[model samples]
Target: MSKFVIKDDFWELFPQAEIAVVVAKRIDNTEASAEPVRPDIIELLEKANEDAKKFITKDPLSENEVIAVWRDAFKKFKTKKGARCSIEALLKRVQKGKEVGCINPLVDLYNAVSLSFGLPCGGEDIDTFAGDMRLTVAEGGEPFLALGDEEYDEALPGEIIYKDDEGAVCRCWNWRDGQRTMLTEDTKNAFLIIESVDPGRSGDLRQAAQKLEELTVKFLGGTARIEFMNINKKEIPL
Candidate 1:
């Protein structure tokens, strides 16, 4: 089993945070149509959009509870909001009348689960990672390649990131994924992460992770494994 570690620095700052990690292996990895969106996935996004509109109507993006937690995190980590987290980005798109569209089988499946649960969910090709994975505050100058970018960028000191032995895999927590580990049509092994700051929402987190596992296995033909971690539990074998 591979190991995934959350550093003490992160727990000390956000003790209430929780994360669900889902690992899938033996995936089909063959190219397939990600559209038109499946009926179940469409329903999930539609309902999530309705829920988001309710709170967004009452307050600005930074003030919305679901997005606020992440905004606060970004502030603590010395980064600005807006493009700080995946969930916030998705919510903003829905607020602007843009429905989340399918990207690929794996991406579409996880996006559905993310919107449904109102959390930041992301994944990477496990094979691209070097050695074990760690979630920690960067010390500065770690190499990172944001999705769709041609050049490498340096991660700021004190910013939270997920990294492997070679370099950073994700920067600013779930804000952006490094290009090297991005999931693609040839991804046979994947590591999916669902993050939540609400302490009382563990049940929802577990359900969302399980749903991702089910969807991945059903659509991508993988064997799924899951692990849960939080301030109370620091590490898990993947």
Candidate 2:
């Protein structure tokens, strides 16, 4: 059976960390690849970019609470050079007066929620995962082909990763996702996550999960269910 499991190895690093999940089924993402982006989705992204500025309390991006928390977490594990949390990537773009562009319907919607909620949000195609999905520290050398890369790379030992029976699904926690299970226009069922390393932001993590579910159901025509994974709960069947 396919399930998403957070191994104890990961919890050993950040015991109080919370990962919020949303499993969406029966989605229609064809519009994400359309030439002219839907006007409503465009507005949603624009507002989110503007709203994200509230979290930018410090001049340097690293000083912000959300960015700093992830930065500290990454230091506990090995990661690729220059890899930063996905939320930092999005917030950086917004901080520089640049808008986070749309990728696909599901991606754009999650990016919107990520920006608005100030947490790292990501998703993958549920059908593409090989057997169960796992969150753990890599033993090193799990084959990985990142999004838009022609050659394959390997996950570093001691790095935080999400992997399946086939290979690595995401590397360095939420920094980058692999192309093997990437969400695309043809995707119908999706598994989404919003991660929080700081215990103080637990409320924000939960709010992001709800907002993501609302947007996925409203725009993608799906039945989305939300779940929280922590020390007490570690797995959910896909």
Candidate 3:
């Protein structure tokens, strides 16, 4: 079983933090399409966009309840908020009348769930990970390659990131995934991470995680499993 741990430093900053990890194996990545949009996935994305229109119309992206929570978290970890986290970026795009476009079946499915639930959700190809993964503040200089970028970037000190024994897998907590562990058409196993800082929305987090697992199995032809971790329970065995 692979081990996933939330470092104590992270809990000290956000005691209410929670993460849901969904693991899927034997995924059929051959169906992945960079330009194809699944009708079912499009329906979910459209509905989420419609639902988000109401909240964004009432207030700017910076003032959104869900986005605000993450903004505060970024501040606590010494990183800027907007244009960082996946959920915030998605909301910002929808707020401006842009639809989240499809990438691949796995990515599209998770993006739909993240938008529908208003939470930060991302995943990595598990086989690429070196060892057990940990969520903690960076000490600086960890290698990172943002999506579509060819050159490597360095993580800022004190920024929150997910790292394995080798190096950082994600920089700025749900902001961007590193190319080293990104999910690709060849990925056969993956670990998806959904995060929440609002204690009151634990139910929403679980619901989103369940939906992610279902969608992964439905579209990727894999067996899925999920494990939940919070301030109270910091570790889980895969």
Candidate 4:
């Protein structure tokens, strides 16, 4: 069973929320590809992105739009393709205005799927995550970046991210990932989050993340730690 380190603050943040986490078995020193890629993964991304576009846009974005902000990003991913082009570009469009970076296949996949699902998920290089981890909001003026290596003067507060004793393992929850804990070609241990907007949606979100987990093994040659994080409704995601 996945261990949940629950606190009273969780209920206080999300009085009517139900949250859960999904973690996969850990692997050490597994190898990833350096040749960029061929086609299969790309094709998979194309199809999965289409599915996510439909799923994410279903919600509002700002005040009342559940996933409308995703619509802006979907339009970008739908048309871009290249050895250099990446989901980092699309994320740049919707990060509520922030910087990002580029890790590798595993990290890239996490961003792509999140963009597709429109749910804003993330993955981290477990090597950097250390032993214990938790999710919480940003504290502002943290001085960070996503995958593109851009600079951040502010993260505001209430922005969800997977954090360890060090600080932020995955910033912006599902939106942007940190370069410090990115999955490189040398990355072996990976922690993934298939985030859910609410309790009822957790099942679908978790299932969708499973597909990505499968692909990680198919290409990365390592065991994985997959987690399904059910967002607490009472908690506002910055």
Best by lDDT: 2
Candidate 3's TM-score reads: 0.92
lDDT of 4 by residue, 81-137 (tens): 221112334433454333232335665565556656545555566566544666555
**Per-residue alpha-carbon lDDT of model 1 for 107-191, expressed as tens digits?**
8778888887788999999888888899999988889989989999888888899998888899889888888999998898999
* Model 3 lDDT tens row, 1-238: 6678899988898888889999899987665442353677667667877776654644766788888888777878756344377888888889888988766678878888888888988989888888898899888887877788999887788888899888889888888888888888898898899999999899999999999999888777769999998888898865
Name the runs in model 3 displaced over 4 angstroms: 32-37, 80-83
What are the runs in model 2 whose C-alpha is more than 4 Å off?
A: 32-37
Q: After superposition, how far is residue 192 of candidate 1 from its true place, in Å?
A: 0.4
Task: List all candidate RMSDs to the true structure.
Answer: 2.4, 1.6, 2.3, 8.7
How are the candidates ranked when ordered by lDDT, highest leading? 2, 3, 1, 4
Worst 10 residues of 3 by lDDT: 29-38
Whole-model lDDT, candidate 2?
0.92
CA error at residue 111 for candidate 2, angstroms:
0.1
> Lowest lDDT 10-mer window, candidate 4?
77-86
Give candidate 2's root-mean-square deviation (CA, Å).
Answer: 1.6
TM-score of each: 0.90, 0.96, 0.92, 0.62
lDDT of 4 at 106: 62
lDDT of each: 0.82, 0.92, 0.83, 0.47
